[model samples]
Structures are given as C-alpha cells and as structure tokens.
Target: MSSIEGRHPDRNLINMPMKQNLVKEKHDASLHLISRDFETCIDVCQKALHVLSSTVDLQQASDHQEEMEEFIVIIVQAYAELDRWQEVLPCITQHYSGIENVSPNVLKVCLLLHAKVQEFSTCSALYNIWTSSREGREVNDSDLEMLLDIYVTQTLLQAGKSSQITEVVQSSQLSQDTKERLIATYSELVRETQLAEETASTTALPDLAHPQNIVDRVVAKGLRALRMMLMWIWSVRPRLSTRTLYSLGGLATLLIIATQGFDTSNRTLEILGNLMEHFIRSKR
Candidate 1:
C-alpha cells in the first residue's frame, strides 16, 4: 500500500499564518508521519517542500521569506532519508546563499548531509560560503568537524593518497582536538595494514595441540591488552595536550602488547581468534 493513505489529509494543506504557527504545524505533521506509516512520511515531506517552493513563487502576493527558510530544512531532512542527495544539495546551496537570517542548525544539517553523500566538492564550496559569511564566525559545532574529518579520511584511504591527509592535519583551521582524533584513527589503520602484511608473509601452521594455537588464547590476549591500553589513554586524555604524539605512542604500545600473550577465557576468545585467522587467510 502507498504510504500517503496513512497520513492526515489536512496536514498536506498549507495556509499562511502571520505568526509562527505555520512552521510549528508543519513540524508537528512531519513528526507525526515519522511515528506512523513510512509511506505517509513522503507525502508530508513533499508538502513541506511545496510550502518552501511556493513562497518564492512569483504568483504569490506576499513572500513569506522567513517561513520559507524554516520549511526548507524539513524538506532537506526528508530528502536525506530517501537518499535523494542530489535534490538536497541544490536546496541547501540556495538556502545558504539567499537566506540572510538562516540558523546554524540549518547550515549544520546541510553540511552533514552533503558529507554523507560524498559530495566533497559541494562540501568545499559550502565551506567557503560558511567561512566567509558573518554568520560563519559562530559555526563552532562539533558535528561539522566530525563530518568533514570522516569524509576526508575515507576519501584519502580509498584513493591511497597521503598528501591530502597530511595537508588536512597541518591546516591551521582544524581544531587541535579533531586533528588528534583523525591522527589516531589513521595510525590504527596503518597498524592494521602492517599486521595484515605480516600475517600474509607467514605460512607456518601452528600446532593445534599447542595451547597457543587454540583460537581463544590469541583473541583473549589481544582484547585484554587493547582494553587496558584504551582505558589508560582515555583516563589520561583529558590531561594531555599533545594528542597526536600521545595517540601514536599509545597505539604502538598497544600493538606491542597485543603480540605478547595468548591466554584463553571462553568461546568468545576462540571466536575472535578464528576471525583474525580468517582475515589473515583472506589477505593471502
């Protein structure tokens, strides 16, 4: 069945309210659709989009500029869920340019969705707009930093390009905290890659009769070592200012510890060890 039949018919009808009631009703209707039938969700979303598009219509006698800006956000969110990222990008770009009184919440949502679809070029363009705008000065939200970091990291890893990654790390605009997190993530990836290479070079089979050859022993040792190091670092993280250097040292230490002991606990250890073994085999 179509999702629209489940939604309230009246909610789809838009009327101009001089006060904030128009935006509130629209928000409420959108939320209602979310809680009910998924199909009905689309109808409410399209209605919100219609409200936004019509406000700018030349035929309209009065332009409700602020209300239109508010409704655009609702539409953007709906398009995101449908994975119509292409549609969202233009709407966001237009809003970013045309709206003088746009909120940070709106800009944040646009940036986040743009990042999710791997529209790095568009994100760069929007970033330029945001940085130059007077409103841009207040864009201190962490979500934006996280989205950009993830996009840049994934793009670099997939393309096997380190120069751009290094550039981003050295860039003065990125906060020290975000830079440190990215460095740690990158370091972990490098360690995993090296471990994979080492495993590929070794072909000697471990004796099953030997306790160390048992799956549980290896995983237990790895997890215990990892947990201890993670706890120690997390505890010290607040006090440390040299995040990138500290994270590199911590990961190196953890890698060393992971290679040391192999004491088994239960089936969980066996499962993890078997998983690692499978990973090793697949790499070959």
Candidate 2:
C-alpha cells in the first residue's frame, strides 16, 4: 500500500510537466502559424474559416473562430503592406460581418491604412461597423475619442472640408488635451495648404509677365500683389477670432474696390488709407 501510494504521487508529478509542455507547444504553434508566408497564411485563414462555419463541434468551432479572426488580421496587414488595397477592401467587406470579433489593434491598423490611401468612402463604411461592433464597445472611452479625432481629421483634410473639421474639433466629448493637439495639427495643415497654393500661383505668374506686353505685365503684377496679401491673411487668420477676421477681410475688400477706380478725391483716398492702416495694425 505504501509503495502504491508513493508511485501515485510520482506519476501525477510527472504528468504535470508534460501538460505544461503541451500547452507551450500549442502556443508556439499558433504563433508560428500566424507568422508564416502569405500563401500559407491565406491557407491557414481559410481553413480556420471553414472549420468555424461547417463544424458542428461546439468546442472546435469556438476555438477555430478565435483563431480565424486573428489570422484574418494578419492577412489584412499583409495585403495593406503590399498596397493591394483592392484585395484588402473586398476581403474586409466580405468578412466584415465578423468584425466585432476582430482585435482593436488590427482595426486601428486598418483604419489608418484607409485614411492614408484617401479611401474616405471605405473609411466611412468601416467606421459604421467599428462604432457598432462589440470590440468597439469594449474600447475605452479615451481610445474611442482619439480614434474619432483621427478619423475626422483625416476625413476633413482629404475632403477639404474645413468647416466640418472645426465642428468636430469643438465637440465637448473631446478631451481638452486632445483638442489642443488636434488644433495644432489643423493649424499646420492649413499653413501647408496655403503655402502650396502660393507656390503654384507664383510659378504660373512669370509666364504672364513679359517685357514687351504692358497690359500683361500690369495684370501679372496686380495678381502677384493680391496673392502676397492673401498669404499674409492666411498666416494671420488663425490667430484671430473668426468674427474679427471676417470684419477685417470685408474692410480690405471694400478698400480694394474703392481704390481700383482711380479715385484720387481726398475723402476716398483718406478712407482707403485709414482702412489699410487698420488692416496693418490688426496684423501686429
């Protein structure tokens, strides 16, 4: 009896290490399967999907469903890296019914890629799935806030809808800290766009300014001056309130029109000069 009892404990101890080894092996295999080549990755993902859909075995179906979602993320990343957006879009659309099961990390990567490629239409579609998905519900509020910020910013920038951008940035749900960061990003983008427009206009103006053409020279010079003034306004506009900026802009427009007709009357010139002085002071 004593010998039998001693052997029983020894046997249990021996089996514990084997069980641990098997668990480790299973984990290693899953990782290996995920890291395999593209063809192999697709094969694995498809096999997982097949098992999930056809299997009547509850345990097997549940396990395979989890594995399939993980592998789908891997395959999607692979497609994105190759810039095979066409393939990625279809695959996402077809399997998107299961997106609630997809990991947030994978969702973030997909959203970012869509944003980068200027796929606003796709991004908008995916955002609906994302907002309604179980995984999206599982996301922390702070994370959701950040994701919304990124989406709105990219969408507005791509669409050139500055008004919408301002509306989104003003949301009370957005944290103050994030609001400040987004404001800075918006300001930077505005500056860059203004600079690009100025550069293009400058490059095109030289063709219109010729030595032998008096009319063309005058027109080009006037256009150049107008562009310079616009640049000045764009640079300073963000620093002031919208109301103040609009008032100043209107004043400048009226002065330009009044002076354009060669009105040298004392009252007209004095009014134009006073408006110009106000515009200059506002810049300071």
Candidate 3:
C-alpha cells in the first residue's frame, strides 16, 4: 500500500507541471489567435508542442493527445491565415502519423488546404477518404459535403483531369442537380479538347480572295452581284410570267452593269464609240 501510494503521487507530480504548462500555453495561444496575431499564436503552440513531445510517459502522452491536436489545429489556422498553405501538410503530417489517423474535420481541413494549393494527388487522396463510407463519414452536413465536392471538382478540372472526375461525380453524395452540372462541365471540357485538337491539326491557309486594291474590290463586287442574281432567279423563276421574266432579266442585267461599270475607263467608252462609227459608215 505504501509503495502504491508513493508511485501514484510521484506520477501526479510529474503530470501536474506539464498540465499547468499546457493550460498556460493554451490560454496564451487562444489570446494570440483572438488578437489576430497568428504568428505569435503559432509560436506559442510550437513551444507547447515541444514540451508535449518531451514527455516520455505513454499514459501522459495519450492523456494529452487532445491538447496536442488542438495545438495543431491552431497552427493550421495560423498558417492558413498567413497564406502559407504549402507548410500546412507538413505540419499536419508531423503530428499525425498519416491522414488515416486524423479526425474527419481536420482531414477536411487538410483536403481544402491541398485543394487550395492545387496539389491534385494529395487532395484527391483526401477526397477519397472524405467520401468513403467507413473512414470518411463526416457529420451529415449536406452543405459542407457539397462545398467540398465543388472544391475537389474544381481542382480536378483545373488540372485538366476531367476524365478522372467522372468517378467522383457519379459516386458523390451531392444532389442530382449538382451532379448533372458536373457532368455537363465534363462534357464541355471534352468537347473543347477535341475542338482544340482539330484546330491544331488543320493547316490554316491564308485567304487569297480578300480585296487588296481597286481592281480586286471591283471584281469582288461583280462576283457578289452574280451570286445575288443567281439566288434571285432561283427563288423567282417558278413564279414569273413571260413579261415578268423579261422585266426581271433586264433588271438583273442593269444590276450587273452597275456593279461592274462604276470603275470603267474613258478609253474603253471611246473605243466603243469608234467601233459604232465604223459600223455605221460601212452600212452607208
């Protein structure tokens, strides 16, 4: 009985100081966090963590595991507020042996952090666990699950891994509407990829018909008039009386002349006049 009492008191004495130190650390850390002093909060947490790590007693360490995890959570928030996301995973993995050992809420935090940094592989792994029936059972918060789904989906999309997203989209617990939207997004991405590939493979030739000078412009105008005339005739041919057909033919001829004669030279008109005179004299 004497030996038992002595061991218990000694153990209590050893744990008592550590508990006091942890309480002080938690208070200071909480103050720093409330004050928006993230750096200071992290420092306090680190100091406490050092002390926690120094405890060799297995029972004491197990007893203080919650405190250690709390410190890590504070550290995670501090790093996140600082925009030092790259350091978050290392900090988390340092305390927890692996992601499997992390609590669901903390694992969710890790997933978001990884997604934020666009770390696809790690984010994907966490996402799988987060949605798993056995290990990833988060509280039945529909909104939170949808939000996580959106984040993970966005990460996969940004990485151009839409094919890999199909499984996730189909298996997710999000509503049918959200799942449909994701599928639509995936289809759009695939279409865009195909279009891009087609565009790249085809050799684009320079357009040769674009008018460069007055002559080219006039020729282009004539070609457009010809096309218009053909279309008009095709549309009206079956509806025309003989008289109407003749009138339409004359109208079409005038239209063609107007388009082609605007830039005609005076020399060409003079030559036409000379030919008329020669024909009249020969007739006389």
Candidate 4:
C-alpha cells in the first residue's frame, strides 16, 4: 500500500487542479448569466459539463456531479433567456429522464418554459408524475410550497382550472395549516374574480333601474367601504391609547347594533358587518 501510494500519490490530489478549474469555470459562467451574456454563459457551462462528464474516475466523477448539475442549470437558463426553447427542452430531457431525476431549480425553469410555450398538457403530466413519485414520501416545507405554487396554483390557474386548487390541496400530504392557508388564498382569489366580474357587468349595462345591477353596485361599494374601514382601523391602532381604542370599539359596537334589523336587501353588507364583528371579537 505504501509503495502504491508512493508511486501514484492520491488520485484526488491529482484531480484537485481539474476540480478547481471546473469550479472557477462555473463561477465565470454564473457571472456571465448575471451580466445577461447568455451566449457566453451557455458556451462556458456546456464545456464544463462535457469535461465533467468525461472524467473516468468514479470518485472524481461523483465529486464533480454537483458542479455538473450547476453547469446544466446555467446552460438551461442561458438557453431560456435567449428564447431558445428549441434547444433548452432537448438539453433538459437529455440529462433528466423524469421529474424525480430533476433538481428543483432545473424543474422550476423548465416548467416555466413549458408554460410559456402554452404546453399545458406537458406541465400537467409532469406535475402528475411528480405527485405520484412523491406520494407517501416526506418533503420539506419549502419543496411542498414550491410544488403547490408552481404545479397546482400557477400552472392550473393559467390553464383555466384554478377552481381545482382546493381539491388538489385537500388531496395533498401537506400539513393542516398549510392546507388551510392555501384554501384561504384560493377563496381570496375567487372573491377578487367575483369583484372583477361584477365591475364588468356593471360597465356593460348602464341601466340603473335594474335591481340586480343595483344590488351588485351596492355590494361592490360595501366591499370597498369594509376594506377602507379595516385599513383605517389598522392605521390608527398604533397611535391610539388603550382607552381611546376601547372607545372606538364601543362606538363600532353601537354602529353594529344600529345596522341590525336594517333592510335585508343588501346581504353583502350584513356579511361584511359579521366579518367585522368576528374580527373585533378575535382582537379582543
């Protein structure tokens, strides 16, 4: 063993210079990307990846795998920035066979590229495969969030099936709190969509005599007022003394009492009032 060591030294020591060169090359490629020199970045990354792929030593190759991944990611990004999905798709498919084989960074960029090209079916398929592969497997919070945001929320939303978001979250292995938060976000989105639709309807029909249109306008105005009141409460909260805040709270309660038994034609106002009451009660 001593004789072998004396004759060959350490393989890692011999490969050290090559590794340093590869690292420096990767750094240069990253800098090129930051500088938006996509062409040069692609050239540098591809060359480094090729060199890393050619390494014959198992240990050396393993050591270089991470650097190689970085190279691939850089190349993919450069191609994407250049709007060369024609090349980027092939590059990614050549290296990674499936979602499980891909690094999160590569997956994110490639998914976005697919979506950019209106490849909704491909994105949906990839997401399904990922969910299947990850089933019964434990994932960190960040990864869970990323997958839900990219595949379920943004992708499906763009595909015009965003209503499926809650269903998907319900089926996911996410924690209870995360699922609730995602559902809340989806509800907010639904509310915003309703508001937009209401505005569009009101604009389309200038008839003030229509009862439905009148109700919509009132609901919209009430929503706006509720939002403004909430904002004002939050803004004045810090400046007011506890006694002043209690007085404000008392006045708000009196207002709520005054609103009770008011005409039920505007159900939205009642809902908003209930929400305000619940919020105040929770704060207290």
Clash list (residue pairs), candidate 2: none
**Where is model 1 more than 4 Å wrong at Cα?**
1-20, 32-73, 98-144, 153-155, 158-162, 175-185, 190-284
Write candidate 3's Cα lDDT for 1-284 as tens digits. Answer: 34534566534323567688788888899889889999999889888877665555532434566777788788888898898888877766665655655655677667667777778787777667546633345445454455455554557766677676667777777667878887777778777876887887664533444333454455445545544664466466644444544454445445435644555445434433443343334334
**Candidate 2 deviates by what RMSD?**
18.5
lDDT of each: 0.54, 0.57, 0.63, 0.68
Comparing 1 with 3 on TM-score, the higher-scoring candidate is 3
Order of candidates by lDDT, top first?
4, 3, 2, 1
Q: For candidate 1, which ten residues in a row score worst on lDDT?
A: 56-65
Write the residue-wise lDDT of candidate 1 on 1-284 in tens digits: 22332344322323435235666656675785566543455466455545555544322222344555556666776677667768765665454444233455565566567766766666556544554464335555464465455545545544445446656554525678877877777777766766876887565445565554554465456556654654465466634344543454456445434654433345545544554444334334
Q: Which stretches of candidate 3 lie above 4 Å from their native place?
A: 1-17, 53-63, 126-154, 157-166, 169-284
Clashing pairs in 1: 3-39, 3-40, 216-269, 216-270
Tens-place lDDT digits, model 2, residues 1-284? 34533545432221345335434544443565556545555555555444444433332323344544565666665566566766765564455445444555556656777888888777666655766664323456666666666666676667676566655565524568877787778778877887898999887876447543544344335444654664577576647555665565566555445544443334444544554555466566
lDDT of 1 at 126: 59
TM-score of 1: 0.41
lDDT at 105 for candidate 2? Answer: 52
Best by TM-score: 4
lDDT of 2 at 255: 46
lDDT of 1: 0.54
| Best-to-worst ranking by TM-score | 4, 2, 3, 1
